[model samples]
Structures are given as structure tokens and as C-alpha cells.
Target: MGQTSKKRGVGLEHWLVPQWPAPNTVFAYVTTRIGGVSKAPYDSFNLGLHVDDDADAVQHNRAQLSQCLPIDASPQWLTQVHGNCVIDALDDGVVREGDAAYIDKPGLAAAVMTADCLPVFFASKSGARVAVAHAGWRGLLDGVLENTLKRFPDAPQEICVWLGPAIGQCHFEVGGEVRDAFLQASTSKQGVAQAFRPSDTEGKFFADLYQLATLRLKAYGVCSIHGGGYCTYCDEERFYSFRRESRTGRFASVIGLLS
Candidate 1:
């Protein structure tokens, strides 16, 4: 991983991308495979505890991350079962087993872990709240983004979303069953069918996860969206890609308010 200048009490590490515009209310970031003490495969910055990394090392890495944040609230980690379950951040200190988390209270961090699955961050245009979703293919197919949007209780146009890094379309090959599930949800066969490219071999097709996400967001009337152009599986040096390194560590995408 690369190193960038550290300032504003937020370390600008090369692996992390901070959002533009309302940078104060929607503080979002993704941790790369750097700046930690986990061993190989987990390599340095592994933030997940269930991935077989030493428990002590995971704790140390998480502590280091806490030091970089602007608030004292601990990150509300998700069990991430790859379903559409979304938790309210008001239920702090409780481990929520879900694919997404939303926080209306300032200073409480909403977080999700992933290696190649998409990490979607959400915020209201008024900057009153923010959310983070761990959208793997299953979660996306099951409506994680839609569930996250439902929490807002505001018009879809009042929200802004940022799709974080994940395995890119070029590298995400899928079978017929995976394609069928998405197709079933399609409003128009022409539009959804375009999201998949037929593979040269067998019944496999290359699916664009970002494109799928965008379609879902569009359905809910969200327009101010960004990010979702990086492939963790391809960028080995900067990300801990699970598909690339089968038995590897997980990275985190986090969002919170500044206290």
C-alpha cells in the first residue's frame, strides 16, 4: 500500500478515499491492506476477527483505526449474513447481524467488512444521518440498498450514496442461476439484460455489480451517487481481496459523524 499525508486528525492513507463536498457530516472511508500488524494473507490491516487472524492482532488493528477517527463512538460492526437486514444505530453496543446499518445519532459509526463484496455508504442530503451497507451479490439481489433507503423516511431524491470498492464486472463471472435472480427483478428485460455479458465458456456471464447497484438506486429515485469503480480482486497491492486470496483477511468501509 502507499502512504499519503496525515492531517485534520484524519490520516490520508493512499488506500482510503475521503468523500468530496459535505465532508464534515458524511465522514466515509475504506481501509486498505496496510498500516496494521496482522500476518500474511491478513497481511497488515485486517479488521475482521472471524477470518482466522489472531484475535490480538485484530484488536490492535481496530484500536489503531479508532485513533484516526474524529469521534469517540465505537464502530457498529455487522455480522454481515449477506441478507437485506438493516439495523438502527440507536441500538448501539449490540452486535447487529445484518448487511447494513444506519445511524441518525451523531458520532456513532456505522461499519461493514468486506474483501470483494460492495460496501455502500449512504447519507441524507441535509446531512442529518448516514449509513453503510455490506452488499455482496446475495445482499444486492435481496434488496439491501432498498432496505437502507427505507430507513431514511425521506424522499429518495434527498439522499446521496457512494458505492465503495468491490470486485469489478470484468472479473466477476457468474452462473446462470445468479443471472436469473437479477433478471427476475428487472423492470425491463432490455435494461437488466444489458448488465450481464455472456461468457465465452458455458452458461457463465460476467455481471457488473456496480451497474446492478445503480439500477437498484435508480428504482428508488436516488440520483446523487458516486464511487464504485475500483476492483479489489484486481488491485492486490492495495486491497485484501477474498476472491483473489481465498483464505484472507477482510477490510472495512466506515462512516460516521464528527463530534
Candidate 2:
């Protein structure tokens, strides 16, 4: 597995560049909701059009992000149904109805917008392809990560992944249904059995999304994983958390192959 750099807060209008072993031909970044033109609550960098924010404000924010990408890439945003569907991002401007997308072509980017849900960036160690995933509990339970890995027929051991910001274990309280879903989602080798511990609340557990992701990835043979230390619910100044603020904005996590 590649060693991950400690995530740092990138200032306004900029991006949190994932510090990984990806080649120069591959560049990936996650936008912070710190710079843009939206107003309060959705103040500044809110990138999602589905959030009931002003459409103009969302479009303006997207434009602001597109300008900073490699080769001025336009992100292929998804409708993101929280399902397991993974698509090949072959064209731009069309929103796919899935939680994950991968691309082999250069100068085009695949991205997912999130507040507290985990944004997973994928890359081949050789820089031949890249992908991204939005892994909330539903997607995780229903096999979103596995579906994304299916897009790459190569040995999963050669794939490098970085998990972006999300609600961490400390605050991700879930009911028995969620725990049972995870337990029955995959085999024990995937570590689903250990991802939850009984919370103080009766019949509830504090779930570990990062740990769950690691188990799923390793189970699929992806050995090089990084960047799971961020807690979206805890970092109010840098990340937007839906759990913390239901009416808040969303940030974007993007990955693309470069020419």
C-alpha cells in the first residue's frame, strides 16, 4: 500500500490535492466549500444543483471549479442515486445515474459531490485509468465500491485508492438495520463484522465508514489505500456536513487522467 500524506486544509478557491503515488499524468483533487458565490447556509462553494440552492449560484460555483482543473476539465457530474451502478465516463455534460464513474481518456474528469458521504478516488498505479465513488452507507452496503472495481478488470492489487472526507466512526450512529445490512453485505474477511460497536444509545452502533471501506477494498485485492483520516462532521471550518447542517452545501471530489 502507498503511504498517504496527512490531509491539510487548502485555502479558499483552491482544492485539497490528494497526496498519493499517482503519476504526473494523473491529477486528482477535492474542492472545499470555502470559495464561490453562493449566499449564507449554502454560502460560497456549494456545487450541487439538487440541493435547492439557486441554480445560478450552483452553476457559477461549478464554473469556478472548472477553471482550476487540469486542462480546464469540465467535471462529468452524476445524478448519484446512491445505488451500486458504475458507469464509464465516456462523454461530458451528461449526468449519469449512478454513484461511481471511471474514465481512461485524458482531459476529462469524473467527479462526485458530497457533504458527509465518503468520496473515493481510484487510480491504476501505472496511470492508465482513474475513477471516483460516492459511498454513503446505502451505496457501501449495496456494493458501490465493488461495482466500481468491476470496471477495472485488471488485478485489484494494482489499483490505488484514496478515501476522501466523510462522517467518521465517532459520530456515524446507526440503527440495527444498518448494522445487519453490513454484516450480511459481504464475507467476514471484508471486516463487516468489526465495523460497528454498540453505541451508548440502545440498539444503535457507532459505525466506522473508513474501516468499512478499507475492509471492502482489501477484500477485493486493492492493497494500496490511503487518506481516510478526515472527519467531515468534525471539520466544520473546512468541510460541509449534512449530518451537522441539513441545509448546508456540498463539496466535490474529482479524479482524472491527464495527457
Candidate 3:
């Protein structure tokens, strides 16, 4: 995986650009908690409307995001339910119910909102297709990534993936049942088992989401993985973390082919 670099946009200065070798026609960005207007807790630049932030503020922030994008089209957001639902990208102003969205043509960007859950970005090496997925523990185990990959016409090896900010293994503690569930669902039981380690609590383990996602992608033959050293819980100033603050807002991870 390559290191991600930060770029300064007009209104959003701290947004991240995936450092992977995506084609010039493909554009991807991960917004941080910086920029925009909202009160504390949600603060500024909170893109999630479902987090109880003022709807107008979120819309304003969203408009700001759209204004800053290189493309003219707005991102198509989903009514994410932490399930494995994947859909084609649509920006008709209707919020679709899906955890992942993809598009083969340009114009519309696929986006997912998250505070602590993983956001995975996908782009074909040829820049003809792109997608983004919201993968929490439930969604990941339910095969959201696989479903998103299946929507692409390219083989897994030709797709490039980038894992966005999320709660890292250092703070993502889960019970033994969660660990067992992952192992039971995986073919590489031993390899997947390594992503979890015993915590101080007897029945709890620290789960490495980055490693788990990488393993899942590799299992599908996707080797061009990048991004993922961000811990939303640890980086309080830059990201919003649900585990850190139960009533926090959500940032967005968006990707699309440039129109």
C-alpha cells in the first residue's frame, strides 16, 4: 500500500487524496472533519445527515464538498444499513438503500459516510469504473466488498483498492464471538485469525480491520491495495469517531471517473 497525501481544496483544506497510481481520469477523496459550518460535536464539515446534525448544515457542507470536487456532478449517497447491499451509482436526488455504489461511466460519484466504519474505494486500472463501500464489522462480514467487486466488469486483479479512515486495531476491541464469526466465514482461517489478537480482557480481542479487509481483497485476487494507517478514534481533530464519541458526525469517502 502507498502512503496517502493531503491536498488543500478551496473550502476543504485537509481532505485526503489516495496516493495509489489511479489513472488521471479517476478521482478519489476522503473528507476530514475540517472545513464547513456546523455546531460542536458535529462541528464543521460533518457530511452525515443521519447523525442528528442539522439537516441544513449537512446540506451546506455537502454543497461545499460538491463545489470543491473537480467533477461537476454531485456524489450519490446511500441509506447505508450496515448490510451487503450494492447498487449502481445514481444521483437523481433519491438516497438509495445500499452499502456500496459503483459506476462504469463518468458524471456521478459514488460515496459512503462513516465515522468509525471502514470506507473502501475501488477504481479500475483503466479508469473506466470506480466505486466506494461502507464496511463496518457487520457489512464486512456480510460480503459488502465482494458484492462491490462483483459489480465491476474487470477482474479483481485489475481493480485498485484504498481503505479509508476507520477505528484501528488499537481501539477496535470486540468479543470472541465476533472473532469466531470472521474465522468461520473465511477460507484462510489461520490467516484471518491473525487479524485478531487477545486483549487485556479475557474474552475480548483487538481486531485489525485494515488487515482483515486486505485479506478479503487478496482472497479475491486484488493486490493493488493502498491507504489505511488512519485511526479515527485516535485522530480526534481530523476525524469523527463513533467509538470515541457516541453522538459524533460522519465524514465521507468518495470516488468516481472524472467527467
Clashes (N, CA, C under 3 Å) per candidate: 0, 0, 0
Candidate 3 lDDT for residue 59: 98
Q: Model 3: per-residue lDDT, tens digit, 221-249? A: 99999999989999998899999989988
TM-score of each: 0.93, 0.92, 0.95
Writing each residue's lDDT as its tens digit, candidate 1 over 1-259 gives: 0122222333336457646444456678888887788998798889898999999999888777766765776788778898999897742577679999988877678779999899999888878878899998889989999999999977999888888899998889999889899989778667678889999879999888999999999988999888878999899987888778788998899888665
Alpha carbon lDDT at 37, candidate 2: 84
Comparing 1 and 2 on lDDT, the stronger one = 2
Q: lDDT winner among the candidates?
A: 3
Indicate the worst ten consecutive residues by lDDT in candidate 3: 1-10
How do these models rank on TM-score, best leading?
3, 1, 2
- Candidate 2 lDDT at 71 equals 52
Residue 89 lDDT, candidate 3, scale 0-100: 87
Off by over 4 Å in 3: 1-9
lDDT at position 151, candidate 3? 93
lDDT (CA) per prediction: 0.83, 0.84, 0.89
